[model samples]
Target: MALPLVPRAIAAQPWPALLSAAFLAAFGFVTLYSAAGGSLLPWAFPHAARFGVFLGLALAISYVRPSWFREIVPYAYVGVMVLLVVVLAVGVVGGGARSWLDFGPIRLQPSELMKPILVIALAAFYSAMPPRHIQTFGAIWPAGLMIGIPVVVILLQPDLGTSLLLTFSGITTMFLAGLPLKWFIGGGVAVGGAVPAIFPFLMPHQQERILILLDPSQDPLGAGYHITQSTIAIGSGGITGQGYLNGTQSHLNFLPEQHTDFIFSAMAEEWGLLGGIAVLVGLGVLLRWGTRVAMDAKDRYEMLAAGGLTSIIFFYAAINLMMVMGLAPVVGIPLPLLSYGGSAMMTVMICLGLLMGIDRRTRRDRERRRGL
Candidate 1:
């Protein structure tokens, strides 16, 4: 009987998602290695090392009880909120955003931590709420406050990428909670009308980036340099890529932020279209598994949390890809599991871990219901 438990245990783990994550990380390691002039010391080694450490953290998180997550949601949200405030007070400035808390060698971005906690908080709130109240002001105001507070704080950090991500993730949770669609539609209309009025108030660089998006050639060597070079790198890697480690754009020092925000462009320049498809397929598998977990959740909280977590990953990957391809403005969002950054890697892994735990509970609940 004890021996038979071995295969059962192995089968219970989320191997498909794990394998997909590993594949992406390994691909990223290779890309970073190439990007660093064949040296692993700077980019490649740390990329792989952080993934290893965070993957362990994810596995540890998988073992946590779902009830514990619900219990900690409020404290976690409040704690991250405090950290965000602290960041505004004394955070280190990098990439023109005062978004990181520097503790000697360890740098923490509280905004990244807010993404999942916000999901859990919203899920817990809605799960505990009476069904009748979901359509009332009680529902909309509280959830809006939860999203708006963090967003306002982050925007003060002048980190547009993270603020948009938080807003989108929060909206995803609200939508999953069965909130009325008309509110979202109306909000979209309002935002659309407000954009024109808000344009002039934006920072000069921010306004220039938006303008550059429309006409890159007008400022190809200035504000548009990143997009122009990224486009060339991606376009040059037509089919099979320019052959790994031989990407002209990156190797020639033409690609900007090749190890972070534009890492996809660097990979594309070397690995080509086939490499891009491979990355996409890996992400596709991971996302499919995450969606299945949400669909199979036994309770409302689980479903909402899982959906929100999955959306976080989706938004990161989607935005990064679009930014590199010049389809979206460069907003400094890194590709999940593929970019060289500890903060994003930690956030994504935490999401995966939480998702796995939720998936585990869902399976166990199903088994119990069936008298397994």
Candidate 2:
């Protein structure tokens, strides 16, 4: 007879998720090692400490139950929204944007957390509704209202990249929850057309970015310097990198933000095409598993949450990769696992935990259905 599956085995171990997490942590340490570019000992200690903290957070999240995740969606959404408002009121300015809220010893970026919170809230809202009811106009307005609040607040922070991400993630969840394709495509076209007209309302720097994206050579040493350096670093890496820690672009300070947002270019410069592809493959694995979870989900909540989380991660990864590859503008979005930031690390870990919870619950519900 075939052996029965152990709960330990059947319960989601989240290995793909874990692998993605490790690749990020390892890449992070290496990037930080390159970031310091000189002090090996100090870089080693702090990098290890951050990796340990993220490790603990990831493992802790892996153990959380799905029901608990469901129960706390409303509370978490409210709390995160409050924090976003607080960030606007008294947040630290970084890269010409105030996206961080100070809380004594630690600073939090509610916008970072908002992506996942919006996902969960939308999932919960949709799950509570009757199947066909959400398809009607009545349900769509409240959902739009729910997402609009944060989108406006985040945009008021003048953070276009994150605001766009939040809007995309929320709408994606709604779409996955059986939102009509006609509405989705129509809304997309309208937004696409409206963006240019709205461009003038953006801050000068934001306007310059769009302009620069259209023609990167316009101000090569000014607003365009970052992408210019990033492209050079990536191109110089060629098929094989210059070798880790030996990237002249980063080590000599030609590439700005080498340790944080632009680390992909740094890695590409050092490890070349193969290394970059490895990171992409790891991310692909995580996405595939997330899609599986969504497909196997027992209810709309699990499906929507899993699908939304997947899209959030996918979009972030795509944007980061595209920016590094010179295929898109430098929108100042961080690579999900590879970028260095306490807020992003925590937010991503929490998201992984939510995914684990949904996957585990879905597996259990399936086994029970089979009377296993």
Candidate 3:
């Protein structure tokens, strides 16, 4: 029953998942179109180009063997960590945050790279350790170091969003690796206790964001402007939306970062409740499919990596949506695939590539089992 030629490869690819992602990117491009007032130069065109480039990149990476991925995880983590140090030494300041590195042609955010790299490192670390050592401090500290190094670096970069993502991805991987619940609870308690100590070190805007999250009305026109504007935009969009290219808040300059983090509000304004639901449904499909990939993985490394990758994706979608809806602090996390930023686009596509690789591997395994 084995088939020949290009269709064989096509048959193995996850068409459903890829199609789901494509629908989201397309819908997002439409939103970006409105954000740019019907122009494509500023955001939509470049967004499309980057999506094509990164999607192709992900598809190419899908061909890499699982064993090869295992070999590269540690190296990738080390490389990203080094880039973070370089960022610290010579990073550029944007939006009052020193998180990007200027390399003449392209400004890069190395901390974004750590989202996937950190997960891979932690997954590899736990995969190598014996299960008997799971509850031991010996098991805990090394992984903590793996997580802490980049976190501290990114925090100094004062990029709370990326650091939180890295920590979440790493911790989730450890949980999947069989770490006990009590350890997680104790860690949570310790974090709560240490918040007072960490508060002083927070940047002014960071503190303002937390305060804004607590009560946006405190400075509705100043520090709380973003959330206030964002909520207004979202609420104004009734059921079917204001229609394409007709959102007043974004087009009139009332919504900040409309083409980036707050694109969702603009989108909701134009497309309405159904449109918002559509975007969430598409992402939910991707998430559910990704989780299934982890469940179907053949080994511990595959399982941990797949689940960790899914967590990274989930964290971005959940956080960005929450931030826009006034449920969480605006730490500058962008909506995956939808937000207009190369760093987030690159990170999300990499995760998709890893998922593609896992899904492809699963198919190959099944085919082999049937003696195809």
Best by lDDT: 1
**Candidate 3 residue lDDT tens string, 1-372:** 666667866767888778888888888898898898899978999889989999999998888876687888778888888888988888899766789989887888988888887787777788888889888988899999999988998899888888888888899899999988999999999999999999888999899999899999999999999999999999999999888899999999999999888999999999999999999999999999999999999888889999999999999999999999999999999999998989898999999999889888887899899998
Considering TM-score, which of the candidate structures 1 and 2 is the better prediction for this target? Answer: 1
* Candidate 1 vs candidate 3, TM-score winner: 1
Return whichever of 2 and 3 wins on lDDT: 3
lDDT of 2 by residue, 252-360 (tens): 8999987667889988998899988888888888889888888988777788889998888888888878887667777778887777767766766777777887877
What does candidate 1's lDDT look like per residue over 44-139, in tens digits? 999999999999999999999877999988999999999999999999999999999999989999999999999999999999999999898798
The estimated TM-scores of all candidates read 0.98, 0.92, 0.97
Q: lDDT for every model?
A: 0.93, 0.81, 0.89
Q: What residue runs in model 1 are displaced by over 4 Å at the alpha carbon?
A: 1-6
Clashes of each: 1, 0, 1
Model 2, global lDDT: 0.81
Best by TM-score: 1
Model 1 global lDDT (CA atoms, 0 to 1):
0.93
In model 1, what lDDT does residue 211 have?
87
